[model samples]
Target: MMKRFLILSALISLSIFSSDKIGRLPVYKIAVEAVPATEEGIVLRDFIKEQIQSTSRGTISLPLKESESGNWEFDKEGNPTLETVANIKRYTDTDKLVLISTEDGQAVISFVDVLHRKLEYRNSLPDSLSKTLVSDFLGFLDKKNIYLALSETGSGSNAQLKINSLKPTYVAGEPIRFEIESAEDNYVYVVLVPENQKGEPILLFPNQIQNDNFVRKGDRVTIPDKRISFKASSVPSKDRIRAFASREEWKEFQLRGKKEDSFYRLLPPAVTGTKTTARSMTVVPNTLTASIEQSPVMEWEYQILSR
Candidate 1:
């Protein structure tokens, strides 16, 4: 039996692609998780405030909307907690957040991406702030583009992953085959979203039958390696496909219920951050060089039509 999400080539395709009930991706928002009340924290907060509103100061536009979240909640490790990070997502219209606090008497700042679920670790005030502050502050909204970012790693990864042999289009009842080419070691998952775009997408790989998602680098994995088959849907629709590969083993948060041939249903990523824990990519402040690691995320969209 296949795990779920992935359909067996022999099983006829059905319907299931939808982005969000809103009929489109939702716009993201930003917020200030909290500013420290300590003398250093206050100073840092003032500096940030003066910078972000400079663009609107004398202009006809509105001031930077700032919410002073009461206080900071630290975990046992002394770093900000995930629940605190989630607070911004839960309480505000912002998709991103800037947190200011004093760490060991030094003023530090962290950039939290609520949508992507990452925190750019703290950096010293002197080394981080500058004239471009406002632009950078508001620019968080466009900071990450999944389609483009996942496609280009800024640098080709050691475990380069490729999706190939998929036809640009497919018709109902037709056999569909594709290849997931990658380096010696990497984990991967693929999702199919039907044209209707109404609910969760279908997981296409790592099914019960093919439960092992791990493959060596430079490996070319073919769907339906077995004699059984997978055919296009008898019902016509334009569907989308998303695949993710990384050195780290990862899985999307799935909903609980009856399984379709043991296939799992994934939560919508845009709003609920279903795969937010997985790397969508986060960057630290300047004066910090990023070490090479994590493929971040990957996706592909294909047109499957039925006549």
Candidate 2:
């Protein structure tokens, strides 16, 4: 059996792995994110940034994007979510993502290394922000020196993710119907944010009924488009819809909620995207792959507030 890869982002062409882009390397931008995004988290985020830069003596470049909202929300599983990542991408331009999360004065961090396809360097804050992480980061670059070369190729140059129609507000229990279209064939993933105060983001597409997520271009899609015994969800509890449109297959997402239940939950992505199609509240991939970051993606979101 093959090992499962995380559904972080679309894989760029394998050729970039062939050579380090004509013998060139970039300083590489690293973005630091805090889980929970509290004042302490923000403080820790800043502290770690300063410490790393100072400790590295200069090779590691971690630029705090002014566009960052510093709101690192997580799924119920206490993991950083894809929605958060997509939001970051929508707001900032970063080559690598570093997630720092702490509790009870203890901290842990994960760095997304696309070249190795692995998450690197996890230790406590202030103390662990040592030269080891920087050395490893720089060492990988110096050795493999794989930069995301995305100039000559693009997955869907003609594709666009758009909302065809959606009501600003709907009466509780009313049929939720909306329109979304893409100019080219694409794999569209959608998640629903529930109205509950402690609710997690749920995977709305690739559900039990509508298992096929590949949509043809030029045809407007009515979501929940499964051709079986189903219609729109009338839960009236969900208020937000986040959609991701990309031209490549994501890694794989694992199931969260138990089967034989009313709904299945996909806790989602252990560095891989989900494929089970189970209806579960899950997180999207925060650390995307180089190919995905280099390629075109549509992250469309809308929320209907309760009156």
Best-performing candidate as measured by lDDT: 1
Stretches off by above 4 angstroms in model 1 are: 1-159, 225-229, 251-262, 267-295
Q: How displaced is residue 31 in candidate 1, in Å?
A: 15
lDDT tens digits, residue span 163-256, model 1: 6776666666677777887655767766565444323455557654566879787878876455435666555445555555556654333332
Candidate 2 lDDT tens digits, 129-161 = 433333333333321121121111224332466
TM-score per candidate, in order?
Answer: 0.40, 0.38
Candidate no. 1 TM-score:
0.40
